[model samples]
Target: MHIAFVSLETVHHRDTETNRRLRTICELLRDAGHDVHVFCAPHWGGDHPQFEQDGITYHAIAESTDARSGVAFRLPIALARAKPDVIHVTATPPGQVAPAAVGAMLARTPLVLEWYGDGGVFPHRWRRWAAGRADRLHVPSELVATWIREQGLSGDSIETVPNPIDLERIRSVDPGEEVDVVYARRLDEGANLESLFLGLAELRRKDWTATVIGDGPEREAYEQLASDLRIRDRITFRGECSREERIAVYRGAHVFAQTAEHCVFPTEMCWALASGCVGIVEYHVDSSAHELVEGLDRGFRTTSEAELADAIVEAGDLERLDYDETFAEYDRSEILDRYLVQYRTLQDEQGLL
Candidate 1:
């Protein structure tokens, strides 16, 4: 099977969850003996129009000087050249949906659009038209699939495929006991790190240490807040760690704290839980973390900062958490097999099987 992935940004340019997932999917498909190709805009040092790496082909549709223009102008040519059996495009806000849709039509291939964010009906005419053009819509969660259906997408058009995680890699080592709590997320306004700082300040009355893993625009402000609360000494901000470093931090922490006001099935929290850390999520109206942690003994959903502090304290008392049963469905191999089934089904429907 020949599968071509169309996206605006390359994983080499941005270290985002969607880009990472795209790369993972390509790798999985390639490993399954499928010919997988990624069509994306060029990134830094990626001057070639086409290159092969890690058993997959990468075709640059446009240079970084003007990626949007490149997508509109060059994507169809690239798609025609690749002549993929099925076209899989990933859509985020500001994605190249229109261009990808056009390319798929030009190639006369079955199109699959993967929505990478919280599902909501797109109100814009172009976006709606682009989404409607797809032969199938793949979403990451049931919540998103339901929301898309509420927006009038037919049940047959939408499929809920949860994000994939490398469970073996996440569970490779035993958790350390050096850090009492760990918070991992971009320190942006939506992350609500201020609440975590306040809650940690409250936890200072007890003996606890925390390490913040990640970096963003709010780093300085969060550090200052930690200082103002006089809990700076007990916290360390290790910004934007490598994958190995992040896994180490998760292993070293006894508890993982999520204070984000908005989230869509966070991968880091899953990694933390799978890495043997107890999970605590501060509840918010827009957050989907509760969906993952609710009803699990090792996980707690807190409605208030006070509750978060208390949950952290309670988590510190737990000796171990068995996340295998809860996270079994998220295994990378299982998710890859699901995607393969979807691809083969599309191929069979199109008489390409």
Candidate 2:
């Protein structure tokens, strides 16, 4: 299958969660023997498509929305060039869907959409209508699937494809005697990271260390909060890293604690599990956490900091949540197989399988 994945904001845009997932999924599809191409508006503040990286092909094109009208301006040409068997879209912004809708129509390709987050954030009808028209919809967690249906759509349109991990990248890390808690996500508006710092402040008194492995807008605020909490020495804000660095951090950490309550898929937590850490999740709701806990059953969900703190305390005793079981589903071969299946299914639906 020739698959074209379209997204204006890609992981390269900022190395955020959704982009990371998009990269992993596209890689998996390519590894499975399907021809896959990625399309994004290069975040380098330029226009036109960027070509293949390593073996993966990318087309970074002209894009402007309320901020950039170039989104529609870029797609039709890219679609004509790609001539994909299936066009998959990620994160459908209200005004942006028309570009996707137009591009897919012009290319005469059926569309598959992987909605990255809940519509509650968007709160608009244009997105809803566009979502309904897609050939198939993917949600990374059941919680997200539920929310999609709650918005008056058919559950038949969606399938759950959890965020994938680079099993090989994680397998290289040798777990030693390191005892640190790891939190790896962007520190942006949606991430309520300040609370995690305060919660860790309470834990530092117990001879535990915390590892933060990402950068975001609140870097200054979070660093200041750490200093104010007097846990600065104990907290290491290892800024954006190559995939290798992240696996190293996860291997050395004993627990993975994420307090963000709004993610459709708290990808770092899944990576930590793949890295063999005991997962401690503080999701706003249990949807994503339940999916995280499916393997080793290591995830703990709480709505309050006190509860999150209590979870941390419990996590201290969890000697080993053998990640192999949690990560088994994401084994390189298995992930590739799943995509092969999705590709074939889509092709069969188009009489091209």
TM-score for each candidate, following the candidate numbering? 0.86, 0.80
lDDT of 2 by residue, 205-243 (tens): 688778787888988888898999999888888889877
Candidate 1, residues 1-353: lDDT per residue as tens digits? 89999876767877676777788788888887999888876653646677888888877776652445657778877787778898998775344677778888788788898876643457556567788888899876666676677777677888877667777876665555479889999888887988878888887888888999989999999998999999999999999887767877787778888889877677788888877778898887666777778788898988888998889888877985523446777888898889888888887887776
Best by TM-score: 1
The per-candidate count of clashes, in order, stands at: 0, 11
Task: Give the C-alpha miss distance for residue 25 in model 2, angstroms.
Answer: 2.8
**Model 1 lowest lDDT segment of ten:** 62-71
lDDT, residue 322, candidate 1: 29
Q: Model 1 lDDT vs. the true structure?
A: 0.79
